[model samples]
Target: MAARILAAALSLALAAMPARVAAALDMAGVFDSTGPEITISWEYLETPGRKAEMQAVIDGFAAMVDNEFLPRDPHAGIEIVMTDDAAHFASYMRRNYPAIDIPKYGVFVSDGRLVTYSRSGVGTVTSLLLPGLLRDGYDDLPQWAVTGLRTYFEKFYGFWETDAAAGQRVVRFAHGYHNPWRLQDIRLLLPDLKLANLVSDTPTVDGTRYQSQQRLLMIFIWKEGKLPAFMAALRARDRKMYPTYLEAVFGQPLEALQPRFRAFQETILAHWNLVMRTPPSQVYADRATFEAMTASVWR
Candidate 1:
């Protein structure tokens, strides 16, 4: 009788066990542990070269995010779903609403689901947003910070030239200098900017251009002769810092900096036209290509 009762109890306990765990178990509050694993559905995944290229992009984004933002306050195990089409992008965002917002630059999402759509041949983290601001974890970062970060990335990591003598980097337009942006630019504002915003928006005011330019200006102020003084001012974040730093760094006031900036711009344009005769490669179809090309260029 005792053995029978024990056996019945064991059977009942076994019956209570679930056949499968919940499919949506929250992991670290950012990801759904039970949801499908994050994937990079690149068409080129079958090709060894393409697969590696896609993997590098994933790795780059992870590095960029980790270096730029997440270290301060890592949430849950966030997963990134990389898609190449508008249909997939829309589906991903819709399925992951409240956790996402498409901004003027790119899709800004929380620990929930997020997707980066890059039709551009070369997908780079610098082109998306500055790693610094992302690292800083500023969801509502000022316009200056956004532009500053963009400029910083282009100056350092982009397939462009930076000249201390010229002081400004010439940004080649996708259509022309006047045209808004090319496929590369799209990566800069994916998942966030609506089609209308992309069409109408111009680099004006304290917008993208200003922020970008400010980065160069900041670099000029700090790295050049006025660095020590500029650092002191920056630490304070004082309104007067701009003027004092500007004077110390450039030996000119804010009003005087524009013409100098223009001069630098002209020098850059002339130099860009002279040296960059060939258009840079649009897509790094695989990692080897990117590695081969950038191996010498990037450290």
Candidate 2:
């Protein structure tokens, strides 16, 4: 009876304990680096070089995502759990996510934890994570926005390269235009790309076709210098006055802006790669060199 009473009391105490305290109690010795954006705890007993490499991976990921795609402090300090122990990773993931099946790497959306295996290639990790985070961040925004933030994100990130020479490792990051996403069939989808329909609560040529169509809307608002306010309205979920917000964002009547939006979209679609998609080489290499190589894109 005493043992049962003590166990019950301890359970109550732990249940009432703060989450940070419970986490520390659970893994007192293995806590690792804490960053402004993310805290990392790892279960790797590897060489110092390998350890540093994993930390670099974590840091690079944080840098890529440290933007408005997610609101500031969305999860109140999200955490990364890195491990080389495949068996333990599998067991813990199974326990935490019973019904849903995730691959070797995943984020616990509500619990504020993301798990990654150290040996997994960097490209794999970054590609998978961006969309998940983008989807989550954009969730609070109006659904009509499709939050096109993910398309904007892909234009700058999702490419990784590594090179080492003369006792130094040089890591290179590169990004290009959006993937094909049925650009060939875009002609078939073009007729349905009216501005009003794109922004309405309906599927516009399936999800893939929405990227460039929605991107045009974002750029139009961005050019009008009201993109931030427009996003704020969406993020605040201010649907009651969103029509007013839209009028303000466009700074013109809907009929007037619709044709302007379409023309802008058409001009860019003429040469999608050259017009809008800035390649990574254009970002880092000298302008003259990139122009000679990729023709007119400035790095």
Q: RMSD in Å for candidate 2, one decimal?
A: 12.8
1-299 in candidate 1: lDDT tens per residue? Answer: 11111111111111111121111000111111221223334321143454334333333233333322233233333333444444655665667564645433323334443344444222133434343334443444334434443443332212222223334321111101111122233333322332122112354334443443445444333334454454344334443643343444455555555555545444434454332332343423333553454434311
**TM-score quality measure for candidate 1:** 0.40
Which parts of model 2 are misplaced by more than 4 Å?
Answer: 1-37, 43-71, 83-100, 104-110, 117-140, 158-179, 182-187, 210-212, 219-226, 235-246, 273-299
Error of 1 at 96 (Å): 4.9
Q: Model 1 segments beyond 4 Å from truth?
A: 1-77, 94-108, 118-145, 151-263, 272-299
Q: Count clashing residue pairs in model 1.
A: 7
**Candidate 2 lDDT over residue span 1-299, tens digit each:** 11111111111111111121111111111122233444556554444554344444444333323332235443345555655555665665677667867674432333566664444433234333444554544554444465454443333322112222222232233333333343443545543366666666665556656655565456566655666677666566654543545665666656676777666556556666664344331122333443354455422
